[model samples]
Target: MTLRRLHSLQQWLKEKDVAYAFIQGKANLFYLTGFRCEPHERLVSLLVFQDNEPCLIAPNMETSLICQSGWNYPIIGYSDSEDPWRLISTHLSSLEIVGSNLAVEKELLSVARAEQIKALSPELALLNCEDTIMKLRLIKNDKEIAILKEAAKLADFGVEVGVHALNTGRTEMEILAMIEYELKRKGIREMSFGTLVLSGEQSANPHGKPKMKSIEKGELVLFDLGVVLEGYCSDITRTVAFGNISTEQEKIYETVLTAQEATLSLCRKGTVLGDLDRKARSIITDAGYGAYFPHRIGHGLGVEVHELPSLNENNQDQLQVGMTFTIEPGIYVPKVGGVRIEDDVLITEDGYECLTHYPKELLVVKP
Candidate 1:
């Protein structure tokens, strides 16, 4: 499977007339080579040349660890104390022509790093390869799809556990802690992003953090979370009312829920992407709460929490099979609290398949 990916990458390299392309971003590194690194100060890059056979470069200490990581590629290591760019330049000078075109990921490469690489090979043509990589990652193959499904399932399970733990007296932090623990218990190696758990008035702030304040009566409880499973990620959000929900709160919840459902209903092969977003917005507007729905209807979800083919006003891309993204419609009224319903969905050949199964009904958790 990895080799197939490598071949595809090499083909892209050849088509672009790229003599040497440096890949340094974690997502790019993981996509090209399955070497997931623990957070540390280290340089991980793949220098692929016109010949298709590329060299994996990293600090000396991690060389063997990476080489044995099932990547099945020749890796070259350099000591941290030594100038790795010198080694890179030497290889470039010996292997490829001095004036050969080289592409660097502008979005991923730090300006300082790009300058450093330029200093290594002053004669090489450097251009941003962001478009190339973006195109490559736009579509997911079978392997990625399976991993994504696992991620979605585990995240849904975590939310379920978190929901059961919510009550009037439970601190927002306590609920978040339980969600984190549940993710670990479910065999999730790590949380994709820190869980977003908001209770009551805190929910009024769109991106508020979990707090020590206790969840109060008659307020919305929002659980927004995802987990990393098999190198992929999942994202989901479920809002349930605790105690008696007021008329305004119920209307907000019902409106957002309707918009979310309408957005998903438009997800099928050949569907106009932007139309779904408009549908969500239309629902909110018709409900007399359009101005409150500030964010886009949805965004693609995969390796990263936010990917591509964003469901917004301007996007014109057609929904395609194998594409997975989020449909989260929200209505946030400051001081009045908020309501949002989100789900991970997969676009199939015929229609769409909903990956998230967490209950969406307004469950009034008693104080």
Candidate 2:
């Protein structure tokens, strides 16, 4: 199952004129090799040549696991004495005859490692392979969407538990703790990213972490979180007012909600990504809060929390059917508070479908 996908990837790389490609980042390694290990100990990598399908370079201890998986590629084990980076030169000697193009993950490779590769392969031309991998991953197949759907359900379950746990006396830190505990109890994987539980004035900060302050009335609480299921990820953010009477707070909430709903309604196949972002931004800007709506509308959500085909102003990609992503529009006012309504959408030939069905309207839970 994994080999077929990898072989297709290598073929695409060849078509892109990428002859010698390296995969060092754990995310890319896991994509190529179905096996995953901690980030520090293993330091596993794969070197895929032009004609060859793919080959993994890893520590000797992990050979048994790789072999047991019955993968299609050869598992070449390296020792501590033989440097992994230098192993590139050993593999590229074949490419020398072919005079191949070498590429690596731009975001993952460190400056030092990149310098080494540049020096070692002075003969071969180097290019960015990250885009190649990202484009392939943008459109999910049936199996991939099924995994994400399950993950979304788990995230919804966690959010339900969090809403019930948001008592008047509980602290933001306490609710964050409960979320972690519930996810762990259900055998859910750790967060692909950090969990956020911000309350009151703290909600003004987009990525605020949980604090020790107790939950209070007349304040908005923002819970930005997700859960991983079967190695796939789900992300959702909901804002609720514990207790409120101010017209301004309600206005802000309603305006942001309207903007998000407008975007969701406009999503469909053949829509330009930048145009999609404009739909949401235009609504919020017309409400006389243009400056408050900062940041891109949303981003692609996938195996790694962020992926390609971003729903931003600079995206040149067109929205194709079978692509899965998020539509989150927010209004932030420093020191006052903020509201963000996000939902994951899957593109279809007919239009776009919202995978995240947990209430688009704001859920106001009393404190």
In order, the Cα lDDT scores of the candidates are: 0.80, 0.78
Q: TM-score for model 2? A: 0.92
Clashing residue pairs, candidate 1?
none
Model 2, position 141, has a per-residue lDDT of: 84
Clashes of 2: 0
- Lowest lDDT 10-mer window, candidate 2? 91-100
Residue 221 alpha-carbon offset, candidate 1, angstroms:
0.9
Residue runs of model 1 more than 4 Å from their true location after superposition? 97-99
Q: For model 1, what is the alpha-carbon lDDT of residue 26?
A: 74
The TM-score values for the models, in the order shown, are 0.95, 0.92
Candidate 2: tens digits of C-alpha lDDT, residues 1-367: 5676677777866687766777787766766677765647445778776676578878878888777756567766778787866675676564543435678888777888778777766766778888877777788888888988888887777677778898988999899889989999999757868888888888877887788989888878888888767666788888888876367778889999998888877788878899878988898899988898888888887777777678898787789888888888888787678888778788988998877777756567775
| Residue 78 in model 1: lDDT | 85
